[model samples]
Target: MPLPLHLLAVAVFAMGTSEFMLAGLLPDIASDLGVTVGTASSLTSAFAIGMIVGAPLAAALSRHWPRRSSLFGCVVTFAAAHVVGACTTSFPVLFAARVVAALANAGFLAVALTVAATLVAPDKKGRALAVLLAGTTLATVAGVPGGSLLGTLLSWRATFWAVAALCLPAALGILRGIPSGRTEEQAAGGPALRTELAQLARPGLLHVMLLGTLVNAATFAGFTFLAPVVTDVAGLSDTWIPVCLVLFGAGAFAGVTVAGRLADRHPGRVLAVGGPAALVGWCALAALAHEPVALLTLVCVQGALSFALGGTLITRVLYEASAAPVMAGSYATAALNTGAATGPLLAAATLTTGAGKLGPLWTSGALLAIALLVSLAAVRGRARRRQPLPPSEVGTPGAR
Candidate 1:
């Protein structure tokens, strides 16, 4: 909606690209750095670990700092890390760079969500978050695929160079686009850091975030291993991998778009419908893996439902923490990264069983079921809170 929001999305696009761009470049990175593919894949894990750590830590540390400065500095650090990765031949150096880059990515996202939320009106908070998060889903459609193509045409190192260079314009835009003044959250004269952190520990906020985490875990569990499902179970060619990716990404784009429209007004109804629909999608995904047409169709549906649910959950976290906005985005970021890191690990475990290529989909179903239970509990909790006190309890000062 606002120019500054678009500018933030521009930066998010670059950051999101770098965050997952390596999925396609891992082999090349391994070959160039003289390591096994397994070893090179650790870069992804390293980045996830860094993000899990950086989100809350960076947000808390920089809670008092200027938003523009935090945003700009994080972007610069991220770009610099990519430069190091592009130039370095040593595996350890590249690994370290990945971690640093993730730290920057996490910090930038945490603050950016807060800044985006603050910039818009209360009613449009969901729309604002969706606009920003669209960059990420768009990255799946364009940035990751583009990076892979760049690596194929040139070198994997060249792709890193491209990612690094992409941030330059974004950094400059952030410098000029975002304001340097105190936001409403800051102007509230928030409590001390210790108190702010304690506020985040409130059960309502934590319940919302936990729901977000479980939903994300389910989403990632299916997604991380989707390529194998396409090739092995769906009986598709390697050429079809990117095509399926495009379809899924397109669905994700559509999902967030729809989510942005209705999330604020109907979060419960949306989640109630979408959550079960997603569970069904996961079940069908596993059962239909052998049927390519069915499999591919489900892929698109899953993407849309997954991201729609995700966007809503993130917005709910913001709503839950509205009274104590400090570090709210950080907690959301932590939940996000926690899900990102754990989903694959859990799915991998399922894969090792007799389930074979369909394991991840099953894992997704199980995780979604858990998330839905949490959602149901949260709904009940809110209903309980909203109920008027009994007449006797209200009348007596210390009713038994």
Candidate 2:
């Protein structure tokens, strides 16, 4: 791996930490800010909404900027946002800070993925992409857990300060590692964004997006309420809650590691397999929440299988886009944010109807099934068309 990839991974770790630290700090924030817990919870939702709006907007705006500069700017913006969030005692002020942090997170992720693609050979892109994306899993495992602990002991404000501190080092690392920004070289008969958009016009892309949306919605809905589900529904001991989260995060980390390698061989097959496995995992979780062993097993599997498709799917989008790596990165990030926002809202409605945790699982699984169908169809369509999506350009004349 190149030095730049390692630096990007570190940067991603800081971004992921900042993005998710709020989940663990909500209670602390609510109490300190003199707001209801529900109100504080809105902070997380607001960030997701910010990501949905920010990803594409950032990409469009930075279309001509040097990629490293774009990424560095985002990191600085995120660090500043965290400082503001920590200092603000006012609810509105903190909320505004969250939006800023979210925009930075969204923009950084989009640009980072585009940078990853440019840093490696075409055949190794999947693994390269995975290295940076892995920071997300690390955040879930290490950052979120540590933040939760810190919020409980010190102050929620202290947690944000810690996040800001971590980011400074990450930004410094990027400065030391990655080269000045560059772009992919064009292939003969290279396709333009319009051509890529036409490919997206196919039912396959629509289905893939739908599936991504469903996967997120179900996961978030159920995940948001996981603590209650474990205690209320499954009757598990509160002491064991961390065990489940650890298991889930471990699964996610392992999934990313494996998916990175597998994507090079069969992006479509990985999605097809992983989606159904996640659907089954969710079903098992709902059916056997009372069975500690079964629940833990399923949660781990759910995390592992569901996320296994992530790198592969992103690579697929970029490949299909015919070297529009930035566009693919932005749009995929947007889709992910859309799902992140939608899943919880939709799940809330389902749970409000007196439907148990299982309701979200059903919805999620159905959506995954749909996504799987779409993936399969896309693969079949590509096979039928006989010409695989064109190879991306190495350094398109004006890509940088």
Candidate 3:
């Protein structure tokens, strides 16, 4: 028996809400904790660091555990950490809780992706992943904004409690829904840890991971500073920022849906189209930041392109790393998180150089252009090897 895909989506929703909601509540949290906003912002960095460190650790430690049990433990720990965060008044204690939650988040996401791939037919892997990631997309659209509103209406603590409460249904669903067995490959005595590591070290797989990292870095470079872009550059009032965010989220949701349908049939084509679209979108955003209509349109297009590229990248990685999908999934997660952490730093540095509000847009456009070139090189390299790619990887439907 297989677990219901919706259950996994629900679990991802809870985890993603916790991961992203902090951005919306930073000011409220800072005021309540008597810390400066800059200091409070470190909490987000801490969560990203925890994810980078935790994904590999979880993959290593839980490789031999039953998949369902491992997922259950992570969800419970994540919920408990949120409870602690909600109750804590001290900044350090809340930060610690954030780190713990992020560790659990990393573990759960890695396992969930592996399980999703296993549950579906090879041809459906891209669609399965798209459904799973839609949860995160919803988190950005609904959870983050709702959490922000909850904090505004009550207190930031209430928002934490609300997130913790969300975990209960997700945990119960996992416990009851996931079938009792090792994952598909693991049940057949999957490759040893050393073997998986060696597979992960392949040059082709490394190129794919690098592409994933670069795509995320480009997306986040502009996204991290979107509020400032909206107000300072687009000349929009602060009140319109949330509306802009919702628009971005809507575009992401739509992009993921379309990518899910097309990726299995055209993985390479998806990347080829999305990478250039994102580059154009970012450059347009840089030049037209002061034009409210153009700025809004570019923002939505940039959001769509980012997720479209991401979906294709994940499908490609899974195809290339078929021998040890679980561990490979963790590597992908860690790489993306590393890029997420790096992007904000890059944007901040650009701003410091007096590049003005357009700094992040131009910076992200440059990164996307480089990523596009790398992607093109990777496609050509894979073609030159003449190795038989999976049907999905070859960008043909039913090639197998």
RMSD from true fold, candidate 2? 7.6
Worst 10 residues of 1 by lDDT: 36-45
User: What Cα-based lDDT does every candidate model obtain?
Assistant: 0.83, 0.72, 0.80
Task: Name the candidate that leads on TM-score.
Answer: 1
Clashes of each: 0, 8, 0
User: Across residues 1-400, which tens digit of lDDT does each residue of candidate 3 receive?
Assistant: 2446779998988887777676567667888999965567667767777888888789878887888898899999999999999999999999999889989989988888888888888899889989998887787678866776687678889889988899899989988988868876777778888888888778878888888888887877777667677777878875566566666767777888889888888987888778888898999899998999988888778778888888778777778788876687788788777777676567656775677767878889988988988877877876777877765667676654
Query: Which regions of candidate 3 deviate over 4 angstroms?
Result: 1-3, 30-40, 235-238, 379-400
lDDT over C-alpha atoms for residue 127 of model 3: 91
Candidate 2: clashing pairs of residues: 184-394, 184-395, 184-396, 185-394, 185-395, 185-396, 186-396, 217-343
Name the weakest run of 10 consecutive residues (lDDT summed) in model 2. 184-193
Please estimate how well model 3 matches the true structure, expressed as its whole-model Cα lDDT: 0.80
Question: What tens digits encode model 2's per-residue C-alpha lDDT throughout 368-391?
Answer: 666667666767877877854344
TM-score of each: 0.89, 0.84, 0.88
How big is the positional error of residue 186 in model 3, measured in Å on the Cα after superposition?
Answer: 2.9
Evaluation by TM-score, superior candidate among 1 and 2: 1
Candidate number with greatest lDDT: 1
